[model samples]
Target chain A: MSDGVEVSVVLPAYNEADTIEETVRVTLETLDSFLPAGAYEVIVAEDGCADRTPEIAARLAREDDRVRHVHSDERLGRGGALEYAFERARGETLVYFDTDLATDMRHLEELVESIRTDGYDVATGSRWLPENRADRPAKRGIPSFGYNTLVRTVLRSDLRDHQCGFKAFDRTALESLLPAVGDEHWFWDTEVLVKAQRRGYRVKEFPVDWTPKGDSKVDIVRDVFGMGSQILRTFWELSVSPRITRRVSLGAGTALVVVALLLMTQYLDPQAVLTRMAGADPGIVLASALVYAVSWPLRGARYRDILSSMGYREHWGFLTGAVFISQTGNLVFPARAGDAVRAYVVKARRSIPYPTGFASLAVERVFDLLTITLLAGVVMVALAATGSADQLLVALTDGAVGATRPPAGGPLSPSPPASASPPSLQ
Target chain B: MTAIVASARTDRNFVRRTVGALSDDSYADYVAGVVERFVGDVQTVAADASAFGRVGGASLLIWSLDVVTAIVVFAAFGVDVTLAVVAVGFFAVSVGNLAKVLPLTPGGVGLYEGAFTLIMAALTPVGVATALSIAIVDHAVKNVVTIAGGVASMAWLNVSLTKAVEESQSAGDVEVEADD
Candidate 1:
């Protein structure tokens, strides 16, 4: 807002000696149509011009107080030159467009006002919008369509036209965006627009009347290869690399393991398993799955109790999810690597130490093993007291020596020892 | 060194043949141009003894850090950190790293753990579970450290890691083209 200037329109001029003066004059006239005198300034950002562009810009700046010449010693590329000029601009709203005046000047007020008064952080004119009337050659339109589609698909951009030269930005928004923008050339504004959207900035895109300039600036090889690579680079930064975080990797790893287990199920005849379930009393099958499902919450509650003893209290639901993820991890990984995953999850999510988590897991495993052993011992003693141990041994020996048979309950439960025993033993 | 040169020469022809089979005449010519550039680069590097020495020394140092990290992780898990144990750890790390170079999985996730566990179980008195635990912990530590460093450098430079890498690669391409 220096010198009470409300808007700064920068024309990034490289070798535009012919159009520099006229562009500045038309820009001033357009600004004057809507803005008060002394409220706007025109900057001829002369980027290392070897022609009469600098001289013309300097003379214009000298003649009119509203026009100023910001010169660079070397080529800063298109984005670089604009960024250089923008840093030195004194207004709250900054605007730029191609000096070719290809876009109609009638839309300048809307473009400026979109940011200045409409509260949009960024505003850009799109030729591809249905309302816009533009006469673009097939050569330019094809490449533009492909490039914009690539940006939208890979970078997840919402804009229809990214490389449009007519764009305006609120000074504060541009300042916040410039630091994260890596491109300093044709891709600069596109990167800014994409990043501004990501940062939740309010951007407005409106259709504008346009005409193709005399010759196109799109070099197929350079623009395609360079900008295509930039799109992938941004994709990697925004999408791929962020997923490399430990928490994300943990989730992804668990998901991959689950997918792998599902794929492994392809080895089984799913129809046969389903047929067995259908034949086996549907109520029993459903009850069995429900029984197995009930064990998970019990496990979670047990883990919560163990953690509580260790002075790390946590909710059973969260603990249940953690346990589920770790068990999923175990299905694929070897040597019970899932134990470590559980340790990591508890430590990361609940602030519990790894050693404490591992200790609790060890205690749980010991209790499980002991319970199974005690139950087996009790069964053996009961069989001996009933004088059926001899019958049981004979039945086991006969079964081992004969053809195997599926359990009576089918795949719903393990082989039924009671059914396998001799009638006397049973 | 001779083995590597022979391998590179074989790979150059292999690449040329593959591209030639897949592409037409103009693309074949482009492939030949790229192969010549590759040959020139290989010759330049092969001619520089000091460069080779520096790279080799740096690689050895990095691998040593990997082994030391494994040893620390094992010690944390209550493994006896004896001289013999350290030697076994070094062998396991080397084998694990070599196995992962095959690119069988992303970031060599499964391969590294498998090789490290196999080596540790075969050479030391550690059981399979203990060996696997040590391997998993070692790999996690190294990966976490690497990810943290990458994130820090990205923040420091105010650029994405991929963007920086792509820029450098493009710059290298430009330099090679200039030389051509």
Candidate 2:
């Protein structure tokens, strides 16, 4: 038992016979120069190595007591091997790095110093920091930038490089974070850092020189999907789980209903409304219904003309039908699901592109608003000429709907305002 | 117009930056491809300016018909419809229709009625009760006709309401796939 070791450097290796030896030798040399000989140990966690990596690592362990090799017959993946080694490490501070040593070893001193002196629980190497230098092909750089950005945005974490492969942690911090990290693969780094940040642990990032060593074993497409799913899962667990969101929604909904009911009670009188509705003239109702019927065809015609202009020629009936169905959908669904339905209907019927259909729908709405505003302008002009604008403004500001009583003897006012004689439909 | 143009430009820049940061070159290329197709459609639409003019003209006519409906309702209640009433009714109808865009209630049912009645009471010599009665009658007329016309169109187009609703709801996702 290396109970006296203050720093334990863990190198998780898999099929890395080519670079593992050099990485271990350089890491040992770096540790020897800065850390005392008996205070630190290098651990090689070789898991499911099909190459000569396990044998070479075992030989090194036999040659030097400072070097220790732990081998697993079955593949536990990089994260699993690290976890296995981490459990057995006896040092106060544990460091882990990829066998390829893609990150510069010179940053090791600062990374260790950050935890040892600066009071940070974890210190990580960041290739994305402004002072950091990363030499890699554009094909790799672009995806790396995008993936890191997605991790930062979705997890809302301050750490820039979650998968930098070079990191050091206080043993206590790792113990607290490891149990919550569910991923056993490449996402392990992200999960650990995210959980650590959420749990209020201080994380420091140091700029490092990173160079591509050899062909990467990662499947970019599969790993991107995997990492993205993990980010979403972590986000859900930390911020938007049903436990929190459902309670918030219920509270907000209850508050809104209470407010609406208060407003309704202040503004509406049920008995007055019932009496007025009972006295409504059927002849005028029929006429208004006819006018509404006329508006539908006009609306349909306008939509047909708009679609035709957009080079999506559909029959007038079809365009009208689409509008009618969408309106009905709006009546039934929330969040304007009707608009989505309308775009779908156009695509399914006319073979128009969805964006084009969406653009047309937007334009249609703009036109409708424009027309309404134009007509309102005409009314405003008339009102200004008659000097009735003040009356309207007064009513708007008064807040009391019943304060501005109509002229008692005016022909427009019903005989008994709220209890007027019922008007006959005939 | 200036405000609209500036807002659109700002929105486009925001979208571009957000997408660029969140995706690779291939995803950007995919987005650019969709934008190009949409631009082509817009250009085609712009080339035929007369069609939009015709549609605008028809919209004006439809709006005028709504004003006439309001006048008829006022006269039926023995309100002695005047020019001022006609103008106020037109303004109320326009405001009410615009308010329907807000999903305060399904089809802006309560909102439109409340807005139209309040506007009538404020602008015309009509009492609140009378204005509310007019508003209710107007909405009932329009909604009943809309439901009837929608059902008829559904039959004519061989679309079931249930199926149409479902399809419309998922249409955006389908469009996303098609865009891809």
Candidate 3:
């Protein structure tokens, strides 16, 4: 595709003295099988090697014109070295790999062919694909699986392996994508691929046999954390910081309130309810309020007992206050959001784990339901035995029928004059 | 050494039995496995024997107060109700209380009122307006007390309602993590 060279294979090496010569020899042989002598060249980026790697690479460069070495006096990371080599590449297509040749050499041809024949702007090798074969211990494999899953979730990308280290790129495509890829370290591969996808470029993935070779230079924990942060940064830049998120949240909240109001108006009669409330007896209201107030302390005592049984011995007053706060939250919010508040109170004030608090809350609910159901069951059986069940059903159905009747005053006539009510049933 | 070999043999037999059962099409084995796990978790949080009376007594007291509140409100409305009628109304109130736990609305607002009023009209010869009036009064008294109590508790504990709600939402997230 270019005047003299069809492909440039860049091997980014750093302190790879042990495997540099063999890697170079195998690469040269691999390229020679498919290309003419001058059609392809191998560039070994000796990235500030403090060992015999630079000397070996330099010697190889001198022995054959096809083998060239680019040296940096200071440490350029894997991405930095690739960036340096890519700038000097003369081929129409560029390929890069780790110095250890972790990927099978057979797939190298397939990667390059994908760009030349399949018309993909970039071809990446995947070790995690279902058809791919990778030989690595669980110690390494587990983290790799986890990291890739995080990448897929956070960046919302479909690439199977972003850190495979064996990728081929169309020269023009790489140059166009390079301006947006700012990472100089391990995250460069992910940034470039994500950006490429966002820009609607076609990327092809090929299954490859990958075997771990030599000791790895990667600090797994550090790199995982660094990549996680980078993923978040990219997500913020590409998605969240925009005005669309705020607009959608605002719109959804408004819709919920409007729908809730509409439902409330449909189901409830505001005028009748207000009228009844106005006529309510103050003395009876005060009595009901006192009974309700008494129940709060009882509820608190129950909560304290449950927590104490669970080995979280909190003061009775504190537990009662916690229940009050949680109940308040329930009253204020919908869907029992206050239950979570209760759990938080337990965790914050008593140092109990949230789950344990939640479990206790669940137990309390079970008891409450059990008690209320038992009472209701006993009363229903009593009513049935006394033959009052039939009368009650008749009255209930009559009242329901009366409610739907057309006339303003039917069997369920508007409240009969309070002073002229029928004689007491007693 | 003999005990160790015996225990290992027992464990192997158990695994073999489990595999054989699961290989069959019958779902009884799966049901048993689920039941066993559930029972094991329940066992971990079982309350101490000593606290049983306190919890039981508190539950009874709370339910009794709910019934009393219903009775008092009905009387206050000048409704001619007998003792038996009062008992029947309490049953209806209990059912309504249980329905409130469903969270159909804030504090089961419309749901509780509908259920309670329907039961009142059915059990007594009261007009729909009277039943509706009774239902509203009953709920208002409870809710007014609840709001007042909540505000007072917030002040007593020095916790803001907003912070409580936020903490509650986050606690739900923590529960999900714990479950995982």
Candidate 4:
């Protein structure tokens, strides 16, 4: 073993005949600046080449025992090659870099510092320091640029760039992350970051410096489309996977409370509401039933559309049944317990991440809330316009006597407890 | 030979069905084809009858934006407006949702209005009084509104009221097809 190595720098190489030897020489010579005082090993994953790439890498390995070479008969792309090399490597802190050397050894030092000392679970490099993406070529860069923007807008992730590949992680972090890596292709980077975020592990994105390497084997256009689809899917998931749906479920349960109140309104002469239900017109009862019955399916359809957009062609009927069963559990129990049931059903049925499937439920609710608010807004406007504004104003001030408040009390608590009944109403 | 026969049959019919499903003009026909399959099925019939069970389950499980709607509508009355009339009016609709949910009681029978009425019953009297007057008139308006809203939604969707009703009816049933 070359100079008794301690760090393993696993580099996955495709048909980079022009840059192969230099990449190997540079990595071996610059090893002093990259690794600690102990021994460092370089692993080149040789796949995807008709050239003498494997031959050159082997000669380097033969000359310097510190350099280890792996020749894969079949090309596994960047992800598979790394998977193979990392599987074989003995490095305590496993790191993989692009052969282009676009990002220098100095950034590796920073990554090493973050991993070794900075109390972070994963230290990744980001190129998202600037919006230089627009300067990039269209077919390759446009989709990726548009994709990251979509994820940030929809998922609202602070990660500037999830698509960049020049990342280094603690050996332990990589080991832990690798098992859950769903995609064996370019989407590997996006998946790893998402899993880290969802699992509540600390993932730090540090901007790195780089020059784009030669005619990149990276079909950037194709991968960006795929990664975008993946990120959106995960965005739908983790956003709703947590207790939000259940909270929403709990919130939906309150619709019953609302219904009860509406029915009560008919009876506020309580005597009359009952007589109306019993007598000539059970009209209110029928209307209320229609609302309750319609809520679930409308919700199911929303999720169906969302899933289809994300590349899962789910049957609405199957989704509706799953939603129905899960919600029933949520309603029977309190505080959104129905979410676990929902997660289980989807995971069991479709084998999707519980959180991603759960997010669809939450997204659906966002729609529902928007719909209800818009309708409520119209109704409120109508009521206010009719000079019933004073009535609407008082109800907002009056807290539920015993009705439990929203756990987050989000929009409901926007106005601090002033109790100032719209002074104009006065 | 058997595999070859199976392959041939799939190639013969599958291609036609795929084209039929994908053609933009055929989507309506494709969806109609599915609906027709369930028309005579017992489980589908049973499902329509027990649609409440599915809808009931959904409210507790779904946790959608509607929750915010109920809260916002209810909150509007007291939170800022502080008018007894508005508070009661918003509440009537929320409870109207709740009472409707009651019948689907594991997903059973009750109304949002009924459930809401109960919540209001527990509230202070003045608000309850306002809530009552609003409930009486709101439904007449709400029905017009619900119908208008439904019609508008159907129109926006480029579907018929018949389809909307079918969707509404089918929406209540949990399993139109078996889960894979």
Tens digits of per-residue lDDT, candidate 4, A1-426, equal 544555678887877777988888887777676555556788988865678888888898899777888888865655777888888887666677888787755677777666656767676777666733324456556555676777676766667777676666677877887887755556677777767776777888887775665554443323444455556656656575664653475566567656766654452455543343233223433443344445556666645665554456777766666655555443454543344455555655677554455445543443334334444466556766766556434544653322323323422232322133331211
Sorted on DockQ, best first, the list reads 2, 3, 4, 1
Candidate 2 lDDT for residue A408:
71
Lowest summed lDDT window (length 10), candidate 2 chain B: B1-10
State the weakest 10-residue window (summed lDDT) of model 1 chain A.
Answer: A417-426
lDDT of each: 0.65, 0.73, 0.72, 0.53
Candidate 3's DockQ = 0.22
Tell me, by DockQ, which candidate is best: 2
Reference-based lDDT, residue A342, model 3: 80
Residue ranges of candidate 1 with Cα displaced over 4 Å: A217-221, A246-426, B1-180
What local lDDT does model 1 show for residue B109? 71
In the range B90-166, model 3's lDDT, one tens digit per residue, is: 78788788778776466667556667776766665664456667777788788887778777877877778778667
Clashing pairs in 1: none
Expressed as tens digits, the lDDT of each residue in A275-300 for candidate 3 is 65556556766877787778888888
lDDT of 2 at A360: 79
Model 4, chain B: what is the TM-score?
0.35
Top-down TM-score ranking: 2, 3, 1, 4
- The global Cα lDDT (0 to 1) of model 3 is 0.72
